[model samples]
Target: MGITLVLMLIFIDSVSTFSISALTDSRNSTTEKEGKNADIIRSLLNQETIIRMALQQNVHILRKDLVTIQEKLTDVETKMSRNQVECTSAMSKLESRLLILIDENAALTNAIRSDLENCNENQLMSSMEIQQINQTLAGFDLKQDVAFTVGIAEFNKTWNSGTLVYNKIISNIGNGYNANTGVFTAPFGGTYVFYIAAVEYEKQDLGLDIVLNNKSKVRLIGNNQAAYQTGTNMVVLSLGKGDEVWVKRSYGKGFHSHGVPLTTFTGFLIKHV
Candidate 1:
């Protein structure tokens, strides 16, 4: 019985040792699985962190681009506003200048119109005066020849050499003498007697001539002397209708008209041709 008890005790000791070895092997396997899981989780966390950083950098760049675009828009708006103001000012100035030009053009037009009116009035007056002269000339009776006498009224005046003396009208009968032109137009074909008289100042020469159709008919001359002198000339002329006659200085010498009717030209119809 002692041998059997010793053998049972040895068998119990071997069974305990086998159980302990099995438990230790199970714990080692559990620890290895946990370490592998932890390593996988850490790698997932690192990938998440890299993704977040990339997203943050993109957002920052986008914000900077937005600010730049906004500033450019503001600058463009400012330039547009300034251009608008300048354009408005220029337009206003141009309008004002146009208005002034319009006013000036109106004034010039008015002045031209006024000048034309005055010119027309002057022309009308000249026409009326000519008409009156024609009427006066037409009033003469052409049935018979008549006589007329005319003289220069300019006294103590120096007449230039070679110039006709024609300034005033003393008398015009039979509508023969034209004061403006210093000419006598024959009223009818007739034999006429013409006479001319002239007086000069002291120490001055005087000359007178009767001209018919630009032909010298008669001449009277007075030389310069110590005293004033008078000259007279007479001529008989046969004139036709529309014949012209006048008195002129024959020589290029100065003459002075006395302060009287001393310078006289007379013509009378003797008989009709």
Candidate 2:
């Protein structure tokens, strides 16, 4: 019994030691698994921290670019406002200059119109004056015509030195000559021409004188011994209105004979002053 007790004690000791060893191995394995799980969780926490830091940096860059863009927009708006103001000022000045030019042009046009009116008035007055002068000249031309031609029908007689009378009238324009007195009266102040002609009876002397205002101006004589002697005289004299011209016998008594009424006198006005 003692020996069997001793064997049983040995067996109990060996079993107890084996059980303790197994329990220790099991505990060590559990601790190793727990350590590996803790390492994996730490790596995941490190990656999450790095990603958060990158996101913060990108947000900061974006905010700076937005501020720069806002500043550029504000500067452009200010420049545009200043340009608008300058343009408005230039337009106002140009409009004022145009108004001034229009006023000047209107004033100049008025002045030119006045000058033209005055010129037309002056031309009208000149035309009226010219018409008056022409009318006066026409009147003078109508009044100044004076002409006369006279002759004697019978002249076979002798007479003393006296005025010769021409009895027959051929032409008497303006009635300037008297057929009974053989005298011509001037109708206007002008130059006058007179002609006297006489034919003496066969071989007889004839003396005739043209008298202007009772003054002898020319003489016609036929005293030579020639058959049918003839004499003629012409005189030009300046005569006033109412001046007289006549033919007269100067020295020889009249043996003046002409069957065809050859004794003649004529007077006419040449020009008027």
Candidate 3:
């Protein structure tokens, strides 16, 4: 403002001096000369006044422009600073949130691991319980704690003594089905192979059919039935525990009394190979 004022003052002095010189020259000058000087001075003064007014207006406009520029600069700087602070705060908040999530994830992982360990423990316990149950089932089949096998004794349908000791006999088999004299109960659970032999009234055309309970196995003698009177007829079978082995003789519809005893062909429990 002070520099603009000094410039304005200098411009006004030059215009004043030119106007004074024109007035002095006009008094001793021709009409054209006076008019020319007067016009020149008037034009000069008008230009100077217009220039001064333009400068003053320009100065005021420039000052206001500068003030506006400074205010805008301050606003921009303030906004930039605020943005930087906001960015920093947002970054800090994001990092804290991420750390918290990581910690939570770790805790969840540990919880899952603990649950897995508990499941494994339960599995082990269940396995032990199953083992105990199987042991109990295995013990159920044993009727006696000890095993005692006596020697074999000869069985005769008529009468017998010695180790045979009168057990039971049924010789009056006529028609229909013939039941065995001995009934051995199952003592344990295992495979048992039985052997039986029958002596019939010798009908060369009769067939001897043998069947086992539990469908353990079946043996039929149709081949030797044709040679019944020739020699002893034998049948072999394999059975399971609690299986009843029975034999029936069919002699072409005759008064048959299978003379060949059920014990003639003997089969005892043999060890599994």
TM-scores, each model vs. reference: 0.44, 0.46, 0.36
**Candidate 1 lDDT, 50-168, residue by residue in tens:** 98998899899999999999999999999999999999999999999999999999998987776566546545754664576446446544454567777666555466444355555
Cα deviation of 167 in candidate 2 (Å)? 0.2
lDDT of 3 by residue, 1-273 (tens): 999999999999989999998987776577778789999999999999999999999999999999999999999999999999999999999999999999999998987776566546545754664576456446454333212122113332332111121122332121111223333333434433343333223333333333455232433332222222212232333444565544334333221233333223233333221
Candidate 3 accuracy as TM-score: 0.36
Candidate numbers, best lDDT first, in rank order: 2, 1, 3
Candidates' C-alpha lDDT: 0.73, 0.77, 0.47
Give the TM-score (vs. native) of candidate 1: 0.44
Worst 10 residues of 1 by lDDT: 136-145
Misplaced by over 4 Å in model 3 are 1-34, 37-41, 141-273
Model 2: CA > 4 A from native:
1-144, 255-259
Q: What is candidate 3's local distance difference test score?
A: 0.47
